[model samples]
Target: MPNRLRRAVAGLIAAVLLTASATTATTANAAPSSGFDNWSCKPSAAHPNPLVLLHGLGGNGPGNYSFLGPFLAAKGYCAFTLAYGQATPAIPVGGTVSIAQSSAEIQAFVQQVRQATGAAKVDIVGHSEGGFQSIYGPKVRGYAGQVGKVVALAPPTHGTEFGGLVSVGDYLGLRPLVDQVLQQFGCPACDELIVGGAAVAKLTTGPIAQPGVAYTVIASRFDALVTPHETSFIREPGVTNKYVQDTCPLDPVGHVGLAFDPTVAQLVANALDPAHASRVVCAFGPPL
Candidate 1:
């Protein structure tokens, strides 16, 4: 890379890191979302398995699922959330570490949830990075048997170009430099999310959906982060993929808002319990 370009990229990375650090500092102490982490709540007969809610990159368990967690719990499901993949004590936001490490944390949490609820399996509702881990934990991290259903919202199952910045970097052969800079700042997962990065390549090597595990992928056309949005869908035989606009044409929800969107919560409810599925009620607004 040219010296000038290198300097520019370094400045951009530093700005992003500083912004992330500021955001985490502000929201790190936020309380857990309502209706989650209820260790004493057991799975009922209708909802046979407890539900695990996973948050996205740069998000904590409480802030991400503030709406969805309570919605599911009100529907008679035992929903739980955890803050995983904390890259450093200084940054309390989750999903900043490598996917492998985060998936291992998920495995341990799943065991704890199963033991607490006495259920054979648990269902997953993940958003963004959490959505990727929903499948990664089962396919790569050996949590398949413990997971029954997975509902992914706005997940970059394939990968993202970060609004074409990643492609630009790859073309300039600056990806390695970018990755190094991000890792030094304790955000290795940021590089791993780039299109054609090592982690995404590993996920694409084999079938994304595991057998005997029900999968549902929900995306939004308005999502700016996961460009083209269709990359969030799984083209497997049994997996169900949907777009929010398919039902609510003008909902205008974005990537981060998907977890807090009522329309998405309804979609998740139907995915988790198809036997009693109902029509989705759409509303217009940003995330709550």
Candidate 2:
């Protein structure tokens, strides 16, 4: 099967799993439920702009925020998430969308948030393809001036092997199929996107970060998706890098695991609140 089709199938699986697992955390005893705690949380003077959460491919906006949005909300940041890159609102799985379009969507979404909240800027957290989506507004649409910070999780800041498969598909004249498949997920450059990952290459083809905003990356040692691991990091002038394995040598957290991991969530929260940076202690296991 073509990688595109394989992804469609995977997206279906992810949608089902997400619906089941994502909603379970909202109950009263949900153990802080990571970011889910902050959905309706009021913004304090310390954190003004609402935090936006972007999900990976095959993810709906609510699925992305099940924990993350609420978590930020509870911590005093108004949290919002939207379904981007979806061809049909009914399905809401992202894969077939265009990077440029998603970036534009993010820019517009940010404007909407700022207008609604009358805030200065926002902090963005993105996972997987969303990592790319989160930065699109800042990089492509020139919203870096308006964005406070960006944190990317398992992002393909550089292209990956998954893109090579798309190259093979394009060379064989499957470009149309690739584009159509990508369109379903609201990704326009599927051929170019997974064709060894050209989005980040293009994003960093010039300067990686704008002058005012901060860039932080969280990467796992055993990421099976963005292979070679280094692709997860964006090397530029104003970026901070953290590797989970570097701190927790015994941590076997992989790509997907990091998305759902509490430790990773705490690191993300700490990143959001840098004053508490002292709380981050790399652990060999859960013992820390």
Candidate 3:
């Protein structure tokens, strides 16, 4: 890679680390985000399925769903979040392990939520890597029947190129070197996310979606990470794919901001319960 491109990649990595650190600090000091990890909350008639919120790479459950958790809870849904793919018991970050391992963790959590709530099926709302697992768990990890619906936000359903950086690396035959660097940094999941990688191939070998499960994918046009943005869409018959700009042209929320954007939250609410669907209210400026 050229010196300039190398510097850019290094800078991006630094930003991710800083963001993770700040998120961890915020989570440690503040009270638990509302509507998460409430074991006593039961599924209601209006919303019979408990919601499972899955975070992205280097994200903890509480920090990722701080906005959406409370948003859904206010709508009378029993919501839950869990941190999976932690490299060690001491690591606060998640989604760093292999994709298959993370899928198993999701499967176990789903089973636990079902048993506790006595609900036959649970809905899933996954952001980024979490979004990938939402489909991977059901299709690849034998979690089909246990899930009712999946609402994926900026999910790299087909995989991403990190704005063509991975593609450039491939052209230069530096893919292996890149993988080694990511592995050294404790993010095997990063390798799996590269376009046409082994993990992505396994996930996309057959149909990406399972039968009897409703699927909705929401992407942001301004997402700088999941480049081309269209990769987030699942080209299946029953799956609904949407861009944030489709409903709100002025909204500029990106990959990380998808979790905090209110419009995205409303879109999630609509997907989880189409029977009570309402118009998505648009907002401006930073995600809140």
Candidate 4:
């Protein structure tokens, strides 16, 4: 009986992970629009805080919210994305940007959105490294209470083994390339999302949560980059955690999929709107 139960549990867990990866295509995270290098747009009453979206390493904000921006605008949310990270002389972005550096960029962008929109706080959504910045970066810089809510789509809250793979790059004589690309971010040796020498762990267990900030983590069990599946969970109190595979049995959102997956996007829209809390099914499994 014990063996049978163990096997069943493992199988169920495997199924969820498989579902997570099947959520969407693994090509590259893309946005619906383009062209925002040193440009600015103002926000109106219907769309407040000038929604800020942060992309991961080597990413441009334009491609970050391709499908999402239009959908959000339709739903009355003023949307915006920013490009960050060290740019190479010949390389175009929408690529890799260090986590710590991008976090600061998020803070500055939030300030800009606030100044433009006249809102005290704004909504922040991040992908990959942007996820860390939205959730933990600003608060670490002493701006915790200023954020109204943080929504992370498949954020590596607990970090990942695949990321650990990249931490080894600098040690193998690619140090100059690493330093030139990363020095702009001023990343310290212990930055978790950077070198993987405890940046993720230190950040995770250190203080992933802050008071007065509404937190929600949207994750997929099929994430190829962040594994063990559960790492995407935000374990802090008062945080509303959502697992797409469990919520929508047919949702085809993996790690990158969650960014544009319509179902997941619908869920994201609901979370951003506090009045519609009942629209979300917060149970562990689909209702019987």
Among these predicted structures, which one has the highest lDDT? Answer: 3
- Candidate closer to the true structure by lDDT (higher is better), 3 or 4: 3
Score each candidate by Cα lDDT: 0.75, 0.63, 0.76, 0.58
The weakest ten consecutive residues by lDDT in model 1 span 163-172
TM-score of 1: 0.80
The number of the candidate with the highest TM-score is: 3
Tell me the number of clashing residue pairs for each predicted model.
0, 29, 0, 19
- What would the per-residue lDDT of candidate 2 be over residues 10-98, giving only the tens digit for each residue? 45435534643454345323322223323433345777656777776655566555545554555556667777766655554543467
Q: What TM-score fits each model? A: 0.80, 0.75, 0.81, 0.69
lDDT of 3: 0.76
lDDT of 3 by residue, 1-288 (tens): 477755654454345445545544443333322234677777788888999999887666876776677667767777898988877656456777789888889899999999988999999999888998898889988878989999998887788987232221222233554455445665678878889876789988989889999999999888877877998899997799999889999997767778767788889999999988999889741321
Candidate 4 lDDT by residue in tens digits, 76-125: 56666766654453433533444555567667877876776567877788
Better of 1 and 2 by TM-score: 1
Clash count in backbone of candidate 1: 0
lDDT of 1 by residue, 59-100 (tens): 667656656776677677778888888755554467777888
Q: After superposition, how far is residue 147 of candidate 2 from its true place, in Å?
A: 0.4
Arranged by lDDT with the best first, the candidates are 3, 1, 2, 4
